[model samples]
Target: MNQPLHLMTPEVRANPYPLYAELRRRPVCQVEPGGMWAVSRYDDVVTVLKDARRFSSAGLGQSFRPPWLEHNPTADSLVMKDPPDHTRLRTMLSRAFSGSALSRWESSIRAIAEELAEATVRRQEVDFVAEFAMPLPARVLNLFYGLEPSMALRLKRWADDLVSIPASQPSPQRMEEIRHSLAEMERCFNALIEARRASPGEDLVSELIRTEALTHEELLGFLFGLVPAGVETTVYLLANTMYVLSEHPREMERVRDNPALIPRLVEEVLRYEPPGQSSLRLTTEDVELSGVTIPRGAIVIALMGAAMRDESRFPQADRFIIDREAQSNLAFGHGPHFCLGAMLARMEARLGLEALFSRIRGFSLQRRDFAWSQSIIARGPLTLPLHLEPSRR
Candidate 1:
């Protein structure tokens, strides 16, 4: 297993489990060419994610943030903060993103899912990524932030760029594109915030506007984090769930028959094939793990996808089984920085799957050949082409 498992490799991108299984033999393997440590096993990944004091999330790409974003209040979001600061930011922002708030949107989310499913079925042959998976989260977020549906497309573009930039070392041209996207996002959010201030709406943005805990600058920066948080990963989650279910006919049939199990199916997909493969963290101080020493200021990557498949934590971890007992999966992350939108992501996915199966019968992949996104940070089919059959009423 001497072959490189660098972030951008095709082998790791296409299917990374075998590589992960090999790397887990050594809980922490130093990835050469870049000198970063890869923590693969479940325990180590948890240790890195949970012990924020030892491993900081702030310095993932020290050179990446452009001046505009560098000064934004959200620049120090929950994702990039450690302990006290992270705790405080999460608490203030959690008010509008609380469980009750998320539950209130369930009916509307289901309706959106139903409408998307109907449209997808009418298309007969469609790319699930573009048609259902992508827009589903965007539209739901639109409703959440009180933005018009027209903003979904531009927001999706901004979010896709935002999520991808930090993970890879982009060329100068790509960096400019990312900066431009960030500027556009900042401008768009600022306008929305001002509108919410003028005439408060029954939405998350308006609610946050009313809060005194976060200043306008901080609120704007947090919104930058929120767009991608609410959109990108969930988009991949929905896409991956559909691909897995369609591949596993028995499981698909079971969920289609018993719609209640749709949530369980979503969980299994998160474990079996997480949307986010890894997250970057910086070592705050020297630390030793599983006999390997990580020097101070070293880059540490927690392989969430690999950890979810750790045999010690998960029985038959490689397989996707919906009925498995409840176990913590790292897909939505762990520790204090656990995803704020996890509840919303789950609702959209569960509802989206239910709507698809209920309205469209004989739904199947149009082709077996598919290309996975070449991003080590996330994993899913880039284009999920499928044929949707009419309902068998």
Candidate 2:
């Protein structure tokens, strides 16, 4: 038997594509540490995503509520629910991202993007992640929720610790930090929910409260789940877009010359170096996939990174072709649980890139060596230093 893949290892976290390719050959097999099944092929991954009956989303809750961690709000969030419950939660939250709502926020989003991009380029040489990528989403989220600026850094720390739990083998010190962060998040969000209840405003929290659809616990779960889902994913998306463009100057020039292609570029980046690498699922019953029978109650991970690169689905699957015909990819997931923040993430990327390339002629990586986020579920550089060339026009 082949040695099971240890996904959390530093090397794999940095670049797992080569190993992903090897796994695709087997298509469905067990991975180590937890003996979870990894579904790597495009068809099989989609099969797992679409068939919520046979492959349940409860695996998310299982993954989140480990023995060491306390009961996480995410364990009961919409992402972990099945059928009627998931549908109800999704309905309550859908209005916030509706067309009119996004239209209202578009100008603000662009303004923030332009301001941050201008500041980053003014530096000429900087860690792109810190100066631009991280702040764009963080600021956007803060504004959307009407959160105080004082809470931004604390919220980010809590989110980082929360999302990293499933992926990290935390030391005692790290465990304490994670626990404390969780407690702090619970306290902060509870207060926010109550404040909105007493006197609502035009912000998302107030908007949700006006609906009067979700219970207090449900509201807490939704807000708790939103931080990591909303902020970290977009941070990675923006950073990965820059990393891809920096490495492929021709594509960068193409996009800079024709800004209309920015959306396409973002789409291709989502397929090529997706922020969320996999979706967690549980086998509700014995399920046969790729000729392998997975037992009931098994943890199955749909490898989005591998599926997006599956040769059968995408031509020149490994190449970063920005104009590759706009076929669907599992970067933001699919079916009932498709990322609710898809529009917001795409809008931020499009505007962020427009703000960036409009000011800078081009950019190149200052150093080839960099660290990737330690979380197995997310992918992107922790620090991306770049030498940016200002636009001459």
Candidate 3:
């Protein structure tokens, strides 16, 4: 009985690395009852991602939901298109999300982090996921789009529903829920796009609206995609990092003392436990990977979480070492389809963690009982209870 790591079994959700290790030992071949191949080894996953000519980013259908859904919002997303189309959409959005553009939000991100940390410090114990991890990204994205924080929260909810559609076995009820979410999202973003067009401001939506390359549908798709791509992923990354730090007090102390180590710690956390575990790609032509022949027109699942732990790629890959000399992890992905919100996520984590640890001296989990989110493509606890020891300083 082969237990595929991509499944959402309770045991796999709790700890999937052992399962991934089992899968990594086999040749890169089909694991799904269907023909979807699981590419787990580090080199092979990189190959699938880099060789876009052979493996297309699209055609797997939006969010891996039922391919026949009429209300699929991600079909026109930049991550779901081939070159020329993908390149054009990415280029226009790139100007809007450029490093310089994102850097301007650093102070605002820090402020949000500080505010959230201050709020948490006053509580005896808090659900960190709800209080800090989730809201920071939502609020930051809200600030980016000039939306009120209230609207940002609603957007996060819609994004969560959108992204979760792929991980579950689809049903009519689920499809209806997805349609509802998409309608609300479209309504929200359309109004925002209109507002940005009337008076372009120093915001992401305005920058995107000002771009000549994107159509209205394309713009809506990008905005719709941003919530899941930006908010949900960031929430998990931050929550996972906090969980990791709690497990390693010594590393936390070191990072708190020297801020320089925070960046490396962030990278290590990404490698050790990426929020997004796997991404789907469609094969455009017959390809040979790891001596296994993958036929054309098949779906290939790039197991990024598994690849990060491949022993050949990172010595002691299973262990989480903050100062590992080789820091080439695929947490933010690689090749042309690398994550668009990678920089923004990193900034939030750094600022969020820094503000968190600095304010609360001795941080620890309040309870051992926690519930992990069930999904094939993402991993993290649904709620993390935490307690902050009084400041020593």
Candidate 4:
């Protein structure tokens, strides 16, 4: 029997389409070392995500499982559990993320997008991640907590430290720094929690505190979550989305022509290059598919990007088809724990892309181009350099 693909290898990380194609050859597969099973074909990937029972999110660590802290009560947090725990947390958090929160922030988010776009245009050659991707969601969500501009930027950094821990064989000092940064986030968020108690604002944080259902720890967990989950995932999505669009200018041209197509085009980009390339879900019980028996507690890194490109589901999967119907991809995940911030993330990508293209005109990669931050769990560009259309001299 042939060995399973080593997903974290440099070559695969650079471009895993070929590896994914191989997985499609064997519909059900398992990787050694971590004993992580991967379902790469579109149907299998979707089924694993859809059925929370047999396949489990608990196999994945807690959403609020602090890297530093030992305990995690909020394993009940939406990203980390199954059935009753996952459902309850998702329900409560969904209420916070609903129309009420996003509706109130529409004007502010629009203004933030406009400002960021304006700044990007001023500098024709820009790095989309820092200039546009990171800031759009960072600043808008910062507004939610009534954070000071400087503190907001620091909070953004803290979130980065938590999510963007590099995979280099670095020193122990570096690891300490990461844990310290997470501690700082806790201190800062606790202060904000106190502020909300004093005088609540019309923001998600304040709204969350008002819920009265969550304890102080739960409230703090949500705040930390809003930092990384809110900022990192959306930022990664924007950067990756921009990279995909810039690489396929013809596809982008289509969107520019039909402005309304921007929304659907965003979906296509997400499926094309998801923020999280792959994620883990453990099997709760022995599950059989395609003559492969996946035992209980087996780790499954659902290869979302590959699933997005499955030829069976997507004809001419390799080609950049902007108008492609993005139904089958598990980009936002599936099941009860489907992404809570899907609407907000989609909105940000739409605004970021629309704002950039409307002003910047043509865009192409420049200098070092995009660099993928190597983590088996997440996939995103650390830096994305692009040469933009220069204003008339």
Leading candidate by lDDT? 2
- List CA RMSD, all candidates: 2.1, 1.5, 2.0, 2.6
TM-score of 3: 0.94
Which is better, 1 or 2, measured by lDDT? Answer: 2
TM-score of model 1 relative to the true fold?
0.94
Indicate the worst ten consecutive residues by lDDT in candidate 4.
Answer: 68-77
List candidate 1 segments past 4 Å from native.
1-4, 61-63, 66-74, 167-173
Alpha-carbon shift of residue 101 in model 3 (angstroms) = 1.3
Question: Which of the two, 3 or 4, has more lDDT?
Answer: 3
- lDDT digits (tens) for residues 313-343 of candidate 4: 8898887677776565677887676778888
Model 2 off-target regions past 4 Å? Answer: none
Per-residue lDDT of candidate 2, residues 1-393 (tens digit)? 788887778889888899899999889999965898999999998889998899898666866788998678878887888988888899989989987888889998899999998899999999998899888888888887788866766767777887887756789999898888888888888988889889999889999999999999998888888888988999999999989888798999999999999999999999999999998888989999989999999989899999999999999999999878879999999888999999999999999999998998888899978999987688999999999999887
lDDT of 1 at 318: 87
Reference-based TM-score of each model: 0.94, 0.96, 0.94, 0.91
Question: Relative to the unseen true structure, what is the C-alpha lDDT of residue 86 in candidate 4, on a scale of 0 to 100?
Answer: 62
Q: What is the Å distance of residue 69 in model 4 from its true position?
A: 5.5
TM-score of predicted structure 4? 0.91
lDDT of 3 by residue, 1-393 (tens): 655434556777898898789888984866643557989999999998887789898776555446545676676678888887888778878866669888888898899999998888778488999999899999988898788778867877887887777746667887777778887778878998998888899888888777667789898878777877888888999999989988999998898788889889999999998998988888888888888889988888899999999998899998889989956789888898998888888999999988887876778887767988777777888999988775766
Clashes (N, CA, C under 3 Å) per candidate:
2, 0, 0, 0
